[model samples]
Target: MAERPKNDHPIRSPDIALPFCFFCMMNEPDPVLRTLKITEYFKEMPTRDDRESVLALSGLWSIAMTRPNNPEFPEIGIFECMAKLICRGISDREWLLRDQNVYIPYYAAHIIGSYVMNRAEFAEIAVESGVIPPLMELLKGKISWVEQRVAVRALGHLASHEKTFESVAEIGGGVVELAMEISSIFVENVYRQFFCLKQRLKYQRNLLTRGLGGVEIENRKAEEWAIQTQCWSLHLLNCFARKERHLNLLCKRDFLKNLCQIWGGLMIPEAPGGIGLLKTLCKTEPGRKMVADLEQVLKSLCVLARSSDERQVMAIECLLSLIKDPETRHRVLEISVLSLVDLVELENGSELKKPKLGNTLTQALLQDYHKIKYGNQKLHSERAKRALEEIWELKVEKKRREKLMSEKEMKKRKLLVGILKKQGNHKFRNGEIEKAAMKYTEALNICIPKMRKQRLVLYSNRAQCFLLLRNPESAISDTTRALCLSKQGSPHSRSLWRRSQAYDMMGLAKESLMDCLLFACCRIKLKHNIPCYAARMISKQANATSVFGCVKVRTFEETKSLLENRQWGNMTIGGC
Candidate 1:
């Protein structure tokens, strides 16, 4: 509130001045404009001191452009510029800058990788720009790990697109050889680390014996780089192996043995990438032959099949592919693979355990084993045929037992329903109509529709309870169900009569008359004295008038009067 000390300057509010100052401080160049300017500077091929700055700027641009929501890079021609940079060979002047020549291609590869990481369109563009040949050359050359890594990653991104994938296979010759070379380097590095560690432990033991503290054995930096290189090389090989020709080339170089050695020796922790490459190679006939030629490949695969890891699934798949070839199948049989298959088939105490193991085995090896074993009639036809017949008989017996058990269970349920129905009848006679209805409902709940006689009786009994409870609608519903259930003899006639009574109570005169006529016709067809017997039953019931009123013939006099008046002319009693 006090006057500000502003001498010659105009008095300014602190709030306004603070915001203005903040705005001035926060002013920065737009990232897109800066990226364009940097890209232009890089294209000028600046001096040696400016080269590192250009690479740093381009690296930042590459990272920023990799974001999904960022604007399209090709709009500014940056993608084309980067592609041209990658495709251009290293100039003699550039090669003179010690290791600076490597950085140029590395940064270009990095920018290309960022562009095509998740974008298939950009990948196709990269392939069409002819960047893959340089990248493959980088992989083939003796280069720094940083340059090789970047090149391999770029090729991998480009290979994800189908168009680019075909180009990689066609243009990128020696890619398999490169991968195998890297794999050998990785294996050698791993063995060196192992021997080094063994020696270090022994030295540490001697030092401890001499009362000096043991030394910490640090892992070599080269081993870490080798592992990363191994993974990327394997990924690239797997990509190329999608084509059969590349796969065949890979197989010719003892590739299966190398992969088996790594996987079986536990050289790398979970080499699923290598295993995946092996699986791709094994898909071809020549590849399978190469795998079969390896000394311990099949044995290692059999051991791997017993593991529970996802890698084991890939191993099993490779084994299955190998067993499809007749030569390889005979080789597998000679190796006594049946012993390994037998482990899965052994009858464990738990029924579920055996089948689950058997399913994995059958899906992978045993199914193919049986196919190969039985298809050759000249080798062991009689023995194979006998085994097949025994298996078939066992399957049939298993099915028969299942069917008999089902029938037994069904009979037991029906027996339970019968007992419930007897209890319901006892309750009904005791005049507990609601309790009797409840019991009948319980019986109906468990009663199967296939038991027509039982279901019909349950419906009829429940309908009687509904009538006693004065629920004529529900009574009609139950009786209708009973009639539909069994349409023969006494049951049908009884259901019809019960429904007629329900209709009469509901004051449905026409429907009641129709049902009564149908019931009388049914009784007449049975050669029973229909009208006399019906009248006797009606007389025994006090509420018979409501049931017979629709016919207008409750008494003999009424019947005679109807006959004389010809009121029955339109109704046919026997033709229901």
Candidate 2:
């Protein structure tokens, strides 16, 4: 440079003390050496100074974000230094360090989490560095949700490793209880204290917005972080629950009730949230019995059972697991049947689709009902037969009426369908999706069976509403109905496309792949992304069918071969 920078001048100001030599700084550009030099400076400081610690931490935080796996930082006492800083931040009463201390614990815990994320060896080193106590302080709400988030995340990573798990677990029942408590309360706390505040700290704003974007982005990131905080705490609890250590604490009736309420929204796809942990608890007999005993919990699971969420299978599995246990089956059968009956007629397929688990559970329930209410005696069997015949006739009668309208009546009904369909379109455009679905239902209800074209449009339109409403099962049913109504030579492409999306939402990769491929082939000008979508579904299906405990993956050659063999001679449809 033509002129030396202010800070690089030979005469340093009283407030601006440089730790490393100028010649050394000019010669040493290596990140590892620079990190070690900073560590040495931190360790050698005669007295604690907020500014120096903050600068050192800022540098380390950047390094941790970029190259977390580097062992040199932790090897040269950085982990130990961070741990001590966290404790000092908690204990420091000086007004001078108070502001800086608020950020120290969050960064420290985050640094510890980052280093130990991928390697258990780093985690073991972190444990030896005495990071547990400081992290525990953050976990217990020594600061705020900002610190608590990183604290729980760091603890979860530590708990995941075999060597460090005991250290975290040894923190005892308090950790589990704290996690459970925090899981239920973190969402409200973050929302009220952070999002609701008129003026927030610069660090809080930076953390929320990641130093970019505006209010909407800040709100969205806040939601994602809030969910993450709750999910991480639940994940921490899941670790203990999986090992079957704190069953009594985890399975407490109030906590289980609170657990039932955690939805783990679509923001974090991989974290199934509280229901995931509840599903894990159900793997044991004690868990099944305790969960089943709560009719309220069973009812909540039933609601989730019919939802279009990714975790819908976990809810169904929990119910089926409960029903399989002889002690709890009767307690659950009545509530389970009410939700599962509508699903039985639908082909739920597999894990990717809604599970056909309902069929087996439903059949078992009916037999149990017949046995319990009507007995196994021959006389009771005859009564059961009569009851079954009456029920069958009721279903037959409803379908029989739809097909038996006169031409004059059909003409009047077709006009009514046209009007209702218009209203549905109007409602949907206005963003009133539920109202739109109802209008479509009204159109379908009165439209005669011969009006296949009108019914097809009505069904397809309603299915879109269901998809928007996140009711994939209903969407699948309506789409299937529309497909069935279309002429054999020309399947309705819109219905096929909607059903494919519904199937994808339910995690039925193979069915989704098949439907997506079929949709791509319809005689319509496809969207530019159609090919990519089909390819994605193929990749997902291939990954879905991977063999357990094997690193090797198989291609979707089988799905491709199956699609290749299918006949597609006459399907002509308009573009979606």
Candidate 3:
């Protein structure tokens, strides 16, 4: 056709090797075929280069598996292959590191971790294929920090599954012991750095006082790594301690002491997760009894309750769990009432509202003072009564403020409705029927149900616009509502007359006749001082004449038979 493209030329340079086709091979559309090809590629690997390629492919597969509707890696032999790779990586550790290929084992464990994340069955497979032991070894700082974090995270994932939790717990030398060791090391490092920083600051301040400026604190990277390690360890322990036996074992360790140290604002960021662990521990009787003895634990929790952070909710929950036991309740009450008042003060209009905290605290105080005994029982009772009264008064005041605000809002809406109605009337007078209807609709929206008279008038006014716009069905609907809202002799006869006209336009002859009959009766009762029975009789005669004049001959004949038996008045044709 035209000159052939360069890529189509048969003679190409041979020196430029073809671009690596790794993704093309992995993206084979059929899952089974793709898995088979990948497996064969793994088997053909006989060199370090081939192993590196396989490791890269493993990372890709791990990412692909996370997407919805992606083909799954073959479960039959994949875990075993990954496990073998991990084992090989452990043996080849020094060479891999020397070659800067630490990512080999990291990606291997990452692939295994991704597999076990949401599926319990695969977790069991990972455990059975001897993946846990290497992961545990990796946590001992034998590898890069990145690799260690990955291994810990993998263990955390595996430990979360019910089927593999016990196995992970066992292979890791017990979750409680492992987590305690890691947390202890982490806490120690944190405090050491903190105290060192404090002393350095003091020295710097002394220098400044002696005519030298202070030096800035150097940020340590290890501290960040320590936090991550501790967080992952806590996550693993939390998963394991869901069972009663593991929880009891955790309580036996000095877990509460370490947690209280963190809880006492040593590191404020860790309190949320620490309190969460406390909540879990208190689920059991022995755990509760142990936590009850830690006075620092109770005081720290009370302090946390007043914080405006999201952690406040968790703190309150943990406090309630502790106070369920009699001894713990007494211990909580021993904390000064002044400190507990924040826990009892209700937060109004707070995004993080916790109404239950105030109620629970009041109940605890009352129970401690009135239901249980102390040395100053009467004084405690009187204090408790006074606190209860204060709480009640606060609640009442909040309700009063809310009620006043609501009334103010209603008055504002009513004022807006009045303005919108006037705008609508001006539009209607100018023959802007659609604009008038829109304004009327806006007015109706702001009109409260208590403003029945205003709503009735708006509906009737909009019905007239609907009639001019040739929407007789809507007109009839609005007028019917207006009539229902009006009393018998009210000035709503115009609404009835308009509805009759709308019915006639819609070819509803029988409905039109009935509305006309009611309208005539209402008009006669209001205009003429006649007895109710006489007014109704004259109105029926007028209804017959009006129907005959408006409807077709066929409809009039059908209606005439229904009204022919009633007595007729000696009225002229124009009198009706």
CA lDDT of each prediction against the hidden true structure:
0.55, 0.68, 0.57
Q: Estimate each model's TM-score.
A: 0.49, 0.62, 0.52
Better of 1 and 2 by lDDT: 2
For model 2, state the Cα shift of residue 170 in Å. 1.1
Q: Please list all clashing residue pairs in model 3, or write none if there are none.
A: none
lDDT (10s digit) by residue, model 1, range 1-576 = 232322111111233222222122224367666555545544543233322333343443445456732445534444555555544433333342322233455566667777777677777766766677667766664333345666776776677567677777776456667767766554343333222332322211221222233333223333344456666667667777666656556876456666753422122322344677778778777777888777477766754443323365567667767766667765654442432333232222123444443344444443444455467433343543443343333234433654556777779879999999999999999999999999999997766546768978898899999999999867766675576455423437776677767776876543455566667778778888677645544443323332112122224444334334542223221121
Task: Please name the candidate that would achieve the greatest TM-score relative to the true structure.
Answer: 2
User: Local error of candidate 1 at 386, Å?
Assistant: 14
Deviation in angstroms for 228 in model 2?
A: 1.2
lDDT rank order: 2, 3, 1
Which ranges of candidate 3 are over 4 A from the true structure?
A: 1-24, 29-31, 42-51, 54-58, 61-71, 74-76, 187-226, 252-254, 260-272, 336-338, 347-355, 372-576
Poorly placed runs, candidate 1 (over 4 Å): 1-39, 45-107, 186-222, 263-271, 324-327, 339-357, 363-576
What are the per-residue Cα lDDT tens digits for candidate 3 across 459-571? Answer: 89999999999998678667755654564235387686777667667664444555666666676777854445434543553454331122233233433443344221111
What's the C-alpha lDDT at position 174 in model 1?
Answer: 69
TM-score for candidate 3, please give it. 0.52
Model 2, runs deviating above 4 Å = 1-52, 95-101, 211-217, 265-271, 345-576
Worst 10 contiguous positions by lDDT, candidate 2: 567-576
